[model samples]
Target: MPKISPKLAICIVYVAAMMMDGLDATIVGPALLAIGGALGVSPAATNMVEVSFLVSFALVIPAAGWLADRFGTRRVFLGALAVFTLASGLCGAATTAGGLVAARVLQGLAGGMLAPVGMAMLFRSFPPEERLGVSRFLMLPTTLAPALGPILGGFLTDHLSWRWVFWINLPLGLATVLFGLLALPEHVEEDAGRFDLRGFALATPGLGLLMFALGEGAARGWGDPLVLGAGLLGACLLALLIPAELRSPAPMLDLRLLADAPFRSAALVAVLASGGLLGMLYVFPLMYQDALGATALDAGLTVFPESLGLMLATAAIGWSFPRLGARRVMALGLLGAAAAFVLMSRVAPGTSPWAVRALLLAVGFFLGHAVLAVQTVVFDTIADEAMGRASSLLSVLRQIGGAAGVAASAAVLAASGGAGLGAYQAALLASVAFLGGALLFALQIRPAPAPQLRAEAEPSV
Candidate 1:
């Protein structure tokens, strides 16, 4: 077992921050119906508030890392935590829907930095062997967050009031800020590099417009000129962003990292896999509660077994990575996730919720294995000097992947023209196909000896 150090203390703090961010995210799921009931608005579309959180989060992830590189990690991270806490209070205090949404946007921006920044600190603190352990340890929040979300959110919503869901983050959020200040080291590198303004202009609008099109298309109709224009313009702009990234010095994101075989294959796999899983997160929660007549707490708990599976698989992968190498372990993960997908496609309208939970739990374990491997490979292969840039790019890609998944699932709804178990099952089947492709990519990762030094400790911008 790796000894816990001061850095481990910081990782614990990171877990706390992640929990705060995640708790707030799903806390409202239980309350959405209630909110709509009280406000007399359709709850089906209340997703806009939550969706806005994801939108701002996706748009700024690349910038977040670059900012850390130019400024200081400790400063940006601590400030972000403080901002998140303050925003959470605002969110809880909100009486109107618009006020709640605005507060959510602030929370999203603050929360976006938590994962990558925390990761930057962790990778830099320890060597590879210990790094994996910390990474495994970090998995706790990722898995636990979902499970914790509904439980706490439900508790608050059931007993005190739905507003308490956001209020609950206050004390914990402040503690996370204090811990970050005490434990996280100050990396005060004055001169990082030039900002890639052209790249930012291309990527940001491209992503932002694309999401706007996706979210609105369902409501506005596909024949809507606005939707078509947004989608087309976003795609064209994104095409330009890639070429721009290839040419720019100190590019906002380094296209070169995509050149590594493991990194490249993993990037594709991450996109497909993340899209499937995250989309499932959006779907199953609403499906069970809304369609199947489950309670908010019941719905949250149903798909949440996946988190436990994820935490367990993450720990196992860390132990196995040294013995099996990254590729083999990743392949193992894919195969397990694929099995869970197969079972998911077989789900019927009346299938047992408990059964569904069990299958999802199994899927999450394998999914975590794949997620951690992709993260390790990206950090492993990128040039040492561009760690911050690489971190941001990875963050952006995951969001893009998640957004694409959500959009694709939304399209499934469009074709079937219904929001029933059938639509949910079709989405699950699509997710299965995505994982099938990722399974092949996992096999292509070339096995090599584990590194002696930590990838994060290597020189970074």
Candidate 2:
């Protein structure tokens, strides 16, 4: 048998790790009630299981680049994967709410580091011109994992046990970690610089608090003192962080990367598009379950076709990217996504589920084009040394965008007075507006040059 290429091995490791990470993040939602009952706590209290993970995840992300630069990408990625797998086991074994929450925090810390560092490694493995290939690999984990999460969780909870949700990661995570240790290449920047204590001091609490506020504000209402206080303080700290990091000789985030036009345009478009897409995802399930009175499993199934559309679009991107260029592809993609949302906004109580499924599939297909375009072009000009920092910054922005999107959807639902079909429609239209805003930014992106293929020596594992 031919020895596996180092790049292929890395891709396999990265995809498996990311799929597990994404799956873990979303899979617990359907099990929350079961977990609460098993642990002798109210379902509301079990929310901390997710909150702990998200908060710790947000807190750790700003430091991921520094860790990767200081400790080499391969070491950091493998270490994080190991810790995540262990935490998954702990989560599965927990008998108390506190134990589960503690384990989740550990899981979040590991996951926060895992994703961006892994992304930096993957991008470094491939040249800029060949990133469309990377994007194709990317679509599987990013699209399928989240789409399948709720369905899998519901099934496992009903047929086996909620513990299986966390336990399921064990084999996948362990296999990926072992493969990664054997195959992943080491990369460390010599001038990684001293730890940015000041930036970390500011960013950790700032992002953590902001994430908490955004998450809780939707459930507890924006006027709640805790939410208001956290939001205000978090905003203030982040405001201060900008100037401090900008002046530091070695910034943690390397905000200066945004100065590149392609990077800036693509990042902005990505954040806006992420907000719309995630918002739609969050709202649609609620709409199906509440407004249409569908079962949880049925609701998840209805949305599953979107993942199929995403997969199909990702497969077609190589053909489209060469012909349309990044600018036209992204612009037309966003426009098409917005049209899908417009149709969704017309959905009512009596609307056919098939129609909703078709609209969602359309949304995923068009949005996939825009998303892959961003991924392909965002780092086209970033140097190899700065890849870690650039990936960290983009990750931070996408996190904020996703949280803010969910919060905005919740706010619109509240304003419309309830979770009725009309309220859900209004919230979806808000997503369309976000897509419209993204289209404007997509238009500003300069067309990427045609890719030139070149053969380079592959490093042996």
Tens-digit lDDT string for candidate 1 (1-461): 33446676777777888778766656676665555455444433444456657766766677776677788888888888899899989987877776876787788888888777777777777887787667656765654665677666656666677778788888998877877666667775677667778987987778777876775565566779999999899989999988899988777778877877766787777777877776666655666655567776776676667767776765576576677777776788778887887687676668987898898788878788777776666566667876666666666776667766666665565455446767666766666666777778878877779733223321100
**Residue-level lDDT tens digits of model 2 in 118-159:** 878878889998887777656655656866987887678768
Candidate 1, which segments miss by more than 4 Å at Cα? 1-16, 25-51, 69-75, 89-103, 118-143, 157-163, 174-188, 318-332, 345-350, 376-381, 386-388, 447-461
Model 2: weakest 10-residue lDDT segment is: 452-461
Clash totals in order: 0, 0
- How big is the positional error of residue 18 in model 2, measured in Å on the Cα after superposition? 2.8
Top model by lDDT, which number?
A: 2
TM-score of each predicted structure versus truth: 0.80, 0.78
**C-alpha RMSD values across all candidates:** 5.4, 5.5
